[model samples]
Target: MKTTIPVAVAFVAGVVLVVSFFFDEGTWVGGISQEFKIWMTIVGGFTILLGAVSITRVNWSAVQRKKEGWPYKLLTLISIFVMAIPSVLPNTWSPLFGRDVGSIYDWLFTYLDSPMMATMFATLAFYIASAAYRAFRARTAESTVLLVTATVVMLWRVPMGEAFLNMFPGDIPNWLNTYVMNGANLAVQRGIIIGAALGAASMSLRIILGIERTYMGKG
Candidate 1:
């Protein structure tokens, strides 16, 4: 009964949303679809709350057990509360309480979180360079072509590299931008997007018809 109810709701909601796309906004189907979207947003908010609760429980359990790396788990719990508690408080209580520009949450996110994220990505650049070196080895004709194309593209991005390209006979940088980036890259991206859209539609149809029970935690 529990599984049947959820599947029925999913089928009805999916059909309504798909059908509503063909109708005018003022029509009953469209209105119902809009309401359903609002309900979806509300459900999304609850899901976020549930996720927070789940994280708290897991970290707290680890801390209580005095597990290896429990100190990091304890820090995680402290950081979560330090960021979240002030953000949820009424701004009327104190200027720094809510998520406004000068508030605790805003300041921490901008100064602390943003810098850490930037530093992490900067550190990752070395790993990316290592991976690129391994990937660009010209073992075959296709790989040789890839290595040359990548070298040209990377060279085109910087001032010294652009100057080096300009040392050549014709407009090499312009040709790379026009052909490699705009022509080939755009075509490949479009093909990938179209394939992904078709796959998503197929999956949605299967779910709507109840043929996909994997989402219901079943094979």
Candidate 2:
């Protein structure tokens, strides 16, 4: 009975949203559907709160037990409260500490968060280069094509590549990078996106029909 009610509500809401998208704005159903979307946003915020509670519960248990990595877990819990408290303060109160943008929050985000994000991406670039080097070997015709295409694309992107290619009469590398990459890459990307959308739609339909009862803790 519990699962049945939620499934019915989800099905009806899904139908309403699909109809609202295809119907004219002047229709009353469309307007009500838009209001329903706002409620969905509010529900999404609650989900974030739920996630925070879940994380805190797990980490606090670890801290209580003094488990391995307990110190890091404690730091994470402390950081969460430190970041959240000032963020929720009213603008009037914020001015006393300085504007949220100019406060400790901003300083932490700028110095701490920005550097951490930058370091992560910088690390990723080396990993990507290593993976590409291993994968782009010319062992097969397909791999050779991919390797050559990647080499041309990389070359045209930098000054040295362009300078070396400039000694040739024609701008073949530039043309291949611009036209071949743009045209073929765009088509492949679009196909993948459309396939993903269709897959999501199919899964959503199954959920709405209750054929996929996984969400309700059933088969």
Q: Write the per-residue lDDT of candidate 2 for residues 1-219, one digit (tens) a residue.
A: 899898998899888998889888789988989888999999999999999899899999999999999999999999887776776676576552433677767777888988999999899999998998686589999888888888877787788987887788888776776677778888898999999999999999998888888987888
Can you write out model 1's per-residue Cα lDDT over 144-186, one digit (the tens) per residue? 9988888999999999999999999989999999999999999
Alpha-carbon shift of residue 52 in model 2 (angstroms):
0.9
Distance from true location, Cα of 59 in model 1, Å: 0.9
Predict model 2's lDDT versus the native: 0.85
lDDT, residue 26, candidate 2:
80
Top-scoring candidate (lDDT)? 1
Cα miss at 154, model 2 (Å)?
A: 1.2
